[model samples]
Target chain A: MTTLSNTQELPNGPVAAALLAGGAGAAMLGLATTLAEASAGVKNLLVWFNPVGPLSGKTGVAVITFFASWIVMHLIFRGKNVNFARATAVALTLLFIGLMGTFPPFFELFVKE
Target chain B: MSISPREGWTVLHGMLFGAAFLLAFAGGFAGLYSLRPEWVTAEGIKERILRLKVGLWAMALIAWATVISGTYIVYPWYRASDATSARSILLADPATAAWHTFGMEWKEHVGWLAPIAATVVAFAVTYYGPALAKKVGERRALMIFFVAAFATASIAGMFGAFINKVAPIR
Candidate 1:
């Protein structure tokens, strides 16, 4: 019965803006790599997706974003009858796609081989 | 249900180990008695034989218990959904869909039942830790660690929606 928003605050004001900020960051990194390496088409595509950062990584900003999310989830899910933790985890994962999909620094290191 | 395919691996392993130990014990008795009949004596042989039989019975009981617990692990795979249910949930291609579900369910069962009971129980413990923490906080958490670990593997399998993953994203 516990929805993702239940007992929880909306993440960081506007979700859209935050997601874009993250996405753009990733895109730039991809473009940067392309520019530095001398490749064109692949560079552009990489740049395009780069802004999103690495969504499924261990130590990147991606992880930080999720860790923040986990903290928030734990607080909201503390005593509710429904499964707030799982719901929040799902919500966090979606939000992270944008946040993690971007950011080159996060991508270069955190993601696993 | 009571009778499920999840028990298959559990049954196999249990039977293997149980039979191995039983054989070893039997061989031990035979070797000792055959090597010495007078000094070892008939009374000694009788006592050894009884001990060996008790050991076999204990092994048999444990093996049976493995078969029982295995049902839950197997249930999700072979018993959870009938063919019709799986077909509807999966992709348009029935063959691919069936194979997909089979693999996914197999992965879940393997992740849950195989390791902990046979190899290491810790694997299940970590997987279920968070969910359990949410349910009961820190108090009885440790006790449920093993159960949580095992169940979490199954939960992950169910959550993975392996069929969907394999289906074309388009």
Candidate 2:
């Protein structure tokens, strides 16, 4: 019987890839918000980007992004070796950028003129 | 200007949507602690962990939904030109004006942290938890994640309630 150590067992390729994908997906949503604000065309297409409107549209976008990325990552990492640390670093960078992208809408909504 | 019916429903839905996710997370944590390695069958432990993992994703989804809805509701309420500011809106009614000073000022800022923290915790647990727990006793890692998640959820709830009370649907 082959006994695998916990370190070698946990967060296998699929899991690491899923995490990285989720982060990237969230970043895309954040970037979308910025794009919606910067371009009138995007704003019209993604009305949910409106700071004053109902958030269902934006929520829907985020949901799509999450699942889409998860699926893509699952496929890409399937039967492949993954470096969890490197994947995490890349994902965190995307998430951070996405987070920064979200600021404009928050600013427009909260701060008084 | 009064909130549109669409925005109102979004806020209402977001508030109600939180209950199920909260229950999932809290229950998952409780179950984790309740399991005794010596007593529970290995299969039983795996099932529990699987449920907990699902809870992590559900928690993240709920956090995002709630944040989006709450922001939609509160942003316009905050920016209503007639009101000038959140404090001013509350000041319009002295009876509830005290809330503005109590913590409403920081509520939005603090509220923003909930989704961020929840997402991070979800990803952390999903990806790194098992391996990390192996390094730092399993019980301690589980406890740490639970505490952080619970704190974020509590803050999310508190600020949601505070914002609704101070600003209201209008």
Candidate 3:
């Protein structure tokens, strides 16, 4: 067994940062999916295509939204310098999406469901 | 005997819930280890991080599947089941409805908290961890995020199990 030194400091490198990013992205995808399904409007819109019929359509939208949002998020942040403001913007955007789905008014006015 | 739609949904819900827990265990280890690379002296830290990245991705996907499946199981499948609705139960028998609605109404929303917390932590860890490492130190920030991720996964898993028990399709 490898004995760990309690005093040993965390190594400074890009690897840790990248791993953290990747992990975070994965977790966010899961959350985004739940948010998407919570918004009935999003479901009705996605289900219009009827990819897998009524039963799995919500799951389909969620899976699609998660991947699509991940791609978009990476595209926005890729190769660019990310700071506090930009990070906050991304988090707020996610939060806004989630909160919007929870709002009845948004769905009542715009979403058919 | 052939399985009813409700029974099938119950099985699917249980399977996905179990898968999420399994994935979370693997991913949680990798995530926590990633925060403190010094713990893994056996292999190259960077290499471990790359190989283990799949754990988090898989965990995320499974978590998504579990949430959506649970939602579908609870709303559509339960609605179609012969069992009485939670609303009706509340009106008829307040004591009995208390048990049912806790899972359907309360736990359903509570289950979302895991994902919400995960999302916020993910953005911060990815974007801000590096930036803030200069001031507060990288290890501290990462530990916070890693622990948060694990906590959320555990919460989601617990919620999954609880909902399945309280609101199983009859």
In terms of DockQ, the best-performing candidate is 2
- Is model 1 an incorrect, acceptable, medium or high docking prediction? incorrect
lDDT of 1 by residue, B1-170 (tens): 35334334534433453334333434433432242333444455445445544543443344334333333332234332444433344644766665444454333222322122211112212223222112232112222222322343343334334443443111
lDDT of each: 0.33, 0.55, 0.45
Candidate 3 CAPRI level: incorrect
Task: Give the local distance difference test score of model 3.
Answer: 0.45
State the lDDT of candidate 1 residue by residue for A2-107, as single tens digits.
Answer: 2222223322212222222222332332333323234333334433223222211111322244335444544654343444333334333442342332223333
Query: Which docking class does model 2 fall in?
Result: incorrect
Which stretches in model 2 have alpha-carbon errors above 4 Å? A1-11, A48-58, A104-113, B1-15, B19-47, B50-54, B57-159
Which tens-of-lDDT digit does each residue in B13-127 have in candidate 2?
4456555556666675675565554555555655665666677677777766766666665555654557656657777887876565444433333334345445545654565
**The candidate that achieves the highest lDDT relative to the unseen native structure:** 2
Tens digit of lDDT per residue, candidate 3, span B53-141? 45545554555565666665445544443346433443357655654434343334334434433443344344433222232344344
Q: Comparing 2 and 3 by TM-score, which wins?
A: 2
Selected candidate, larger DockQ, 1 vs 3: 3
